[model samples]
Target chain A: MPYINIQITREGASREQKAQLIRGATDLVVQVLGKNPATTFVVIEEVDTDHWGIAGETVTVLRERARQGGAQ
Target chain B: MPYINIQITREGASREQKAQLIRGATDLVVQVLGKNPATTFVVIEEVDTDHWGIAGETVTVLRERARQGGAQ
Candidate 1:
């Protein structure tokens, strides 16, 4: 069984969005890896801004940059 | 890359314990499937008692019963 764990840096994703993400991710794994969807498990972890750091910048900082269309 | 997602019904396991569990679990997976540990990603989700329900009982209830030596 292949288990795929995805960490979403932003929390507060609704249940419906979560469901779609799970399905889409599972499908992607199946298509790319040819793994059986039944035995493969997909786990999603909603992360807070404090839990993630990229390039010495926090998620909050990244979001701010994105909002200002910095290097999109 | 094989990702192993582990869901623990009870939360609050220390970092050391989590490390041990992840190592042991990865070893088990390697022993059983001959997979490389380096490429295997192990993610552990510590579930709150309220998030888990088993056999009409919550994890809290199960822990309470287990403490009294109900079952081994």
Candidate 2:
């Protein structure tokens, strides 16, 4: 099983929105990967803007220049 | 780079313990995977006893049967 890890920046998500994102993302993995939801473990991480970085840039730093809010 | 994903329940962890778990787990990935911390993205998810499951069982469900706790 190719363990897929994801940390989606929950910047503008409402409580419901966050929940949907987590559930949907996990479900997507289950559907695409054809893995059991039980074995297909999913972790929903609510990352801080400052803590999470990519390509040597923090999510917050990227967000300032981002035209659109969400990307992956 | 194999994207290693983990869902560990913070059942018996203290505040400091939790931070260490996140830091240490991430660091271990960095060390073992030989991935740049910048590119070596790590997501430390504090799972609930109910939500996080493994092998068709919740972390809590397994913990009851655990010998000394902390395995992987």
Error of 1 at A44 (Å): 0.3
- Looking at model 1 chain B, which ten-residue stretch has the lowest summed lDDT? B50-59
Clashing residue pairs in candidate 1 (N, C-alpha, C atoms within 3 angstroms): none
The per-prediction CA RMSD against the true structure, in angstroms, equals 8.7, 9.1
Please state the CAPRI-style docking class of candidate 2.
incorrect
Cα lDDT of model 1 by residue, A1-72, tens digit: 566666777657765565565667667767888877766655566678877899998888887888998774
Superposed model 1: Cα runs more than 4 Å off: A65-72, B1-6, B9-44, B47-72
**TM-score against native, each model:** 0.48, 0.42
Q: Pick the TM-score winner.
A: 1
Tens digits of per-residue lDDT, candidate 1, B6-58, equal: 79766678999999988998898799999999898899878555333343234
- Pairing residues by index, what is the TM-score of model 2? 0.42
